[model samples]
Target: MNTGIINQQGLVFLNATGAPVLSRADSRQMRAHITKSNFAKRRQRISQVETKGGESNKQTTQQALHRRKRSQQKSQRAALDTNPTELPTTESPPCAPSLQLLRNFRYLVFLDIRPTVQDPVEKAWFDLITSEPVVFEASLAGGMRCWGPDKESQQNADLHLSRATNLLVDRISCEQVPSDAMIGAVMTMAFGERLADNDVAWNVHMEGLINMMQQRRHHGVSSLPPVFRSLIALDFMNHLLGFPRFYHLKVVDMLSSHGDQVLSKLAPIPADLSLLKTAVDAPETGHMGQTSHGVEEPLERVRLATRALREFNDPYVKATSRSLEIYLNLLWPLLFTIDLESVGSELKDAMSEFRIKACPYMDLTSPHYILGLLATEKDSEASAWFLDRIQGSVQVMRQRGWSDPLSVMKRGLVHEPHIHHQFTALLDDGINGLM
Candidate 1:
């Protein structure tokens, strides 16, 4: 059959017989078929277009990329918040001004005092001189004993000098004194007797007294009467300088019961040129003020304490060690404020002696006084000397297997300049020596 458009209504097809056929359908009917077929085809094309548009959207791809980025960021944040070791953390607190001051002062004192000791004996002596009292009585007695000679003679001569001395001898002879106490006492008496130019017999007497004080200080015996201790300290100071009653009383009254009180008392000591000059050039008495410097009477009062320290011994030694420690602790800052250069050498020697001989038994606070004095000095040479000595000491300590040697060195370096360089050099030398 030949199919062709017919009357614009439907498709006509020729039958097998090639004759004209008159059979035909209504126009509306044929038109309906045509419309239906066209509508179906158009629907198919619309569906194709919609499918293509849907395929082109790409929303899923963009969403997936966004999701991956978000996931990565979440992982990074988790990692950042996680602390591995499970250790607790604390916020750093503010620095304490007083503590900083003390540290700076200690560094300066170490620098000033590390010299003048050629041997371990001097070093040990220095340690004993700077220790704090373990016993309340020792502390109280020390304060009183540090005043002047008159007070020492009045209060401590009978108890500490005579009675304590006898008891100490019996204990020492019987070997009843504990080893540490025995060593401390022997050292104390040796140093004390030396200061007083005492011979062997006096030294023997001093040994016992020294032991008793050391033991008491170490153990912190609080039963000691405060008044008795104060009187003992004043008497010790008096004996040290042979100062008269009036001068001793004046100085004794100035001593305070606590560290703060001692520091407050130091505020009034004169720092004028006259005082400085007298301290520098005072004859045979030297810094002791025994010479006729013709200075004000009050200035002499200030000097009395120093004089006592220079002449400290067992009979009147009650609190001189600790008392002087407190006194020096307060006095250096005042003196440094006035004239650092003149006082620097003397301060250094005094502190060094204390650190080396007395620090192990005495208050560690005393060294800070020397440190304050060193800070006041402008001399680089002196500073270098100080640093070198500290480095050497640290090395020695480390070689002896001392714990926290580095800490000790670091402590020495704190608030100091160019210390790292000095320490590095010293450490290298120490390593080489060990090798």
Candidate 2:
């Protein structure tokens, strides 16, 4: 038998009309020729299609670019029509203009006044004054005088003061009182003097003035002048160190010696020793409207004690020691108050006792240290206990609308990233290591 083969477009054809004819060489040659022709045709088609697709894509992209350009031009034209005076004719440079040093000086002065101004109109006036280059230049000259040592420096200082006074007078004349700006100017003068360490006399005079302002007992006085009260508190704390006998006296004592007078002027004093003993010793006293067992309610006792401790007069060392003791004593009941089956109340008691013993030297600033101590025995269990207490306190605060110390501390820890970092670092150190 013989086979005949035909080839066209890279395909082999069998010529089987009449007798069959077969030849391997003829079949191989025919297939090769047909394959080559078909491959060339497919390649050509692919190349043409790719070129057409590329051109179509390019056209679409160009159309989009043109549309975007037109939209931007329209926006710019509309902006010019709406605000012709403000629109720039030419494209602005990418680089920003350098801030003038004088302008910066004015900004600082303006910011100094912003917090004190109650009226929005007065605030806006101060803002305008600060934004002006002339005001800034005047401020810079005055600031420089705050340092230079010469008669000319004194003249410059006087000129700056005159400029500020004139600005203030102008505002007043315009029926816009410059109370906020005047206070800011006064504060700046005091602060500048303090920085220079030039004259203690100015500080003394200011202190006297602040005291006089406070004596007026106006509603605004409390918000207006805290400087004098702060200084008095600092001095009182310092003086207590020298006079150990009076260390028990609180910062409030410097206001007036008579407890009745002081109490009348401010918030009510926390219950006295007599009142506290009565409340604890006899539950019937129930000043806070809670029937108590022989044991005091920890949170209430802490609230009262903290207030009393703040008011306590004593040497710094003795007062702080007493305050710690009182605080620890108030917190001691939490050990028994917790559910023993769930949290191991006996361990809690032991931890509380340990804290009480360590209270003399323990730094309350680092809360993680306290947490570590709690976790020393059965860490997982202790963490659970601490978390539970926090939840309970949060619940109570929600119900009563009054925050507890733990809640305040927890919020602080969450918001302050630095504190949180420190806390986590301390936690990693292990509770037993702290002990």
List the lowest-lDDT window of 10 residues for candidate 1. Answer: 84-93
Candidate 2: count of backbone clashes, pairs at least 3 residues apart or interchain: 18
Q: What TM-score, over all chains together, does every model reach? A: 0.24, 0.23
Tens-place lDDT digits, model 1, residues 237-303: 2232232111122233333332323223333343432364455455643443333445445555665
Q: lDDT scores for all predictions? A: 0.35, 0.35
Candidate 1 TM-score versus the reference: 0.24
Model 2 lDDT tens row, 202-283: 3543553344334333433232222223223222222221211111133344344433232222222223332444555464
List where candidate 1 sits over 4 angstroms from the true fold. 1-336, 349-373, 376-379, 406-435
State, as a TM-score between 0 and 1, how close model 2 is to the true structure.
0.23
